[model samples]
Target: MAAFTASVIPIVSFILITLAVRCHATALIEGLYCGKKNCYDVLGINRDSDKQDIAKSYRRLARKYHPDVSKESDPEEKFREVANAYEILKDDESRRDYDYMLDHPEEFYGHYYRYYRRRMSPQVDVRVVIAGVITFVSIFQYMHGWWRYNDAMKYLLNEPKYRTMAVSKANELGLLSKIERRKRPKEDVKADEEAVLRKMLEENVDVRGGYSRPSLWDVMWVRVVLLPYTLVLYVIWWFKWQWTYFVMKQEYTEEDRHYLTRKALKLTTVQWESIGREKQSELIEKELWVNDNFQAYTNQQQEEMKAKYAESAKYRRYRRYMKNHKPGPIVDSD
Candidate 1:
């Protein structure tokens, strides 16, 4: 048991240290909802204290430890403690939480608040401690990049993962996370897509050099600016290649060309698949347009023949010419 406890001591120590800082875990359950006035009221000020009265009381106590006035060894520390309590009582939300805790005394008992205190208390299938810790740790990774820089050596130097552990203890105490972003459902995504499509149809996408990250023109102008930079860089690169090329000059073979080609076409799988689908859509549209155009041409020819046999002026001229030339009297009026 001693060995087990000994092995667990570091973890416990870290957890207690974590809980002490995060409000939900470190603070007394009563601290949040307590209506009890603090040390400041009992010792520092009277119950009927007004703002001026409170300020006067603080000034008196402050002077006692004023560091300039009081030479008492711990007088400065007492002054600070009184000052902190006074600040909290003055704030509105802090005062509300204080009043709330006072009103609800039975809620924070051993597991009542953690196991059943939340608005989401009904779906209590999983132990909140474990679930809350996991959620906190996952979110912590995304924030601050605080723990990402940690290495094995850093851990050896006596570091607790600050962001992750703080988040976990805070969650354990019922503090909601700040980092979770709300997401839309599938239906909402479709609605958003339609809205964007409507906006696109109304406006031109071509306004900003047309959606290609850099259009060909953009690339060309960038190249124009980069030309001098490119030359300067090339001179540096040439010296490097000249030095290295001589070393490998005898061993260089055509095989290096294949590796160079492979590097240029690198792209994520999603991008390649998206390009394929867009090309397929274009091919389908082209086929349908060609078919529609051919059918339209046939209809137009039939309409021209019908008009020639009827009474339009241009058709009338054709009919007159036909009759004069003895092909047959072309019909006139419909």
Candidate 2:
């Protein structure tokens, strides 16, 4: 039994490792453009279209699809695609990379890596690595905890003191006679003791009401020991695990593909408009316009709103005004 239990770990680990690698590869491949439309296709031109032709096509599409100018329900999204195509084709350096990616997609395995390395240093996504570590730890903890608990239970059941306590408790619960009926003539003492312990466990009452001998759970203090870890695990599971799993599943919708494309191009949402045109032009010149200070501006606006509302005279007065209006007495529904 011990050998069998020990063997299962390596087998399970191997399976998990294999699945993770496959899932990761699938996710990366999903992000790469495969048999999809290129920038030229987006601008209604051929790959060999010169700058003049590309500019003309882009301007026509931009005017037609611009959210502020168009009345279509989804014009903003179309405009985003057109703008991204224009940005790539307009730049000489980026255009070359884009064209290379289009022609040799198999060599462009690192879509996200290339995109990020251009703006920042080359490093693995800390979020993905952290999430993977947390997942592995959580699984190991669950399996190890259960194993320890079972081992502790088995040890307590064989101890003479616990067996006596369990027998006494079994009498109170009217299970002593059931255990007696199962006893065999000239049975091994250890086997007889184990049968009695089994009957006691079935009644869900630990030996000596768990005062003398701790139950499997109490012996490990699983809840107390795991509470903080559980909270952190929950946060990772909620925020990171869902997205990671979704990517690994390799089920790309049209919207998902578009979002990934935008990320590869370093485009934030229409929120870029908030950065003002002059700053936008400067960032574009530096190749930083796609995802420039848009998020910082948004965070700053949120903080300002919080401070404004919190310090407002109306809010202060409202708090004091509510003091005079106490909640009325409760009336029972029954």
Candidate 3:
């Protein structure tokens, strides 16, 4: 019983180790549904806040929480978060993406896919373990294949059919005396082809009686190594594509569209200024823009209106409500 228990322990340990590795790989691939950390709250600002306000908030937080300046336990972490939030809010395109993510939190699959695409990589430890495991296993498999090939050749030389062929090759290769002529039953004539090749190996000749042994490339190199590695990598890409499909298939609600439109309207100062006056008027007439800058007819008045809309009570109320509201788990449409 003790012997049996000892023998089973390693098998159980091996299975557990495999499960841990697979779970880690799957976690890296599937990623997490985003948590409800409001970026606006992180910066102590509202969504309607303009670039200047964002810059000001970021500078204040950086001064307060910088690891060098603050004695807080997680000053560096808070500093990093503040910096990230500022970077997003400072740019029009990135801010829009963030707004979209907040509005449609159920659509996190796409964001996670993009995040893992950029971030997920085999760490040094994982790579080292995988390399060591594959190397040892592959060497064992190769040696086993080599031994089996030799055993098969010895088996073949004893067969009546191969005895004549192998003996002739042995004589020609000056190994006839070294060859052990075995007279086994005729039933053993049906030996594996690899065993026939072994007779040539014994003769010290490169060719297996004029037929060559398969090169490493032609035989088990990929089967023992490349195939498993390729399968693991393919899992990541497969899960990514599956999640992308899930994200795209989700229907956009009216509220989602509204928030997206509002985000689109909040163009960067540079973006708004670069547009022609006629095009700006065209946008205003379409009612797609709600920026206070575009509320004015002239560029001079619009420039004065910058950063003022973000301070309004009504906009702040709306922004506050959106930040506080949390969506539930996403339901599968299918």
Best by TM-score: 2
The segments of candidate 3 whose C-alpha lies over 4 angstroms from its true place after superposition are 1-35, 113-334
Candidate 3 structure quality by residue, lDDT tens digits, 141-214: 66666766655556666667766766567567665444344685444543433344355545543333213343
Give candidate 2 misplaced runs (Cα > 4 Å): 1-36, 121-334
Preferred candidate (TM-score higher): 1 or 2: 2
* TM-score, ranked from best to worst: 2, 3, 1
Cα RMSD (angstroms) for every candidate in the order listed: 33.3, 36.8, 39.5
Whole-model lDDT values for every prediction:
0.50, 0.63, 0.62
Where does candidate 2 have its weakest 10-residue lDDT segment? 206-215
lDDT of 1 by residue, 218-258 (tens): 33334555789889998997786667657557533334332
Query: Cα deviation of 313 in candidate 3 (Å)?
Result: 99
Residue pairs clashing in model 3 are: 152-195, 153-195
* Candidate 3 lDDT: 0.62
Global fold similarity of model 2 (TM-score): 0.26
Model 1 clash tally?
A: 7
The C-alpha local distance difference test score for the whole of candidate 1 amounts to: 0.50
Tens digits of per-residue lDDT for model 2, 104-214: 445655555665455465346787786667666666666666666556667767778766777788677765454443355656555665666766754563323212233
Clashes of each: 7, 0, 2
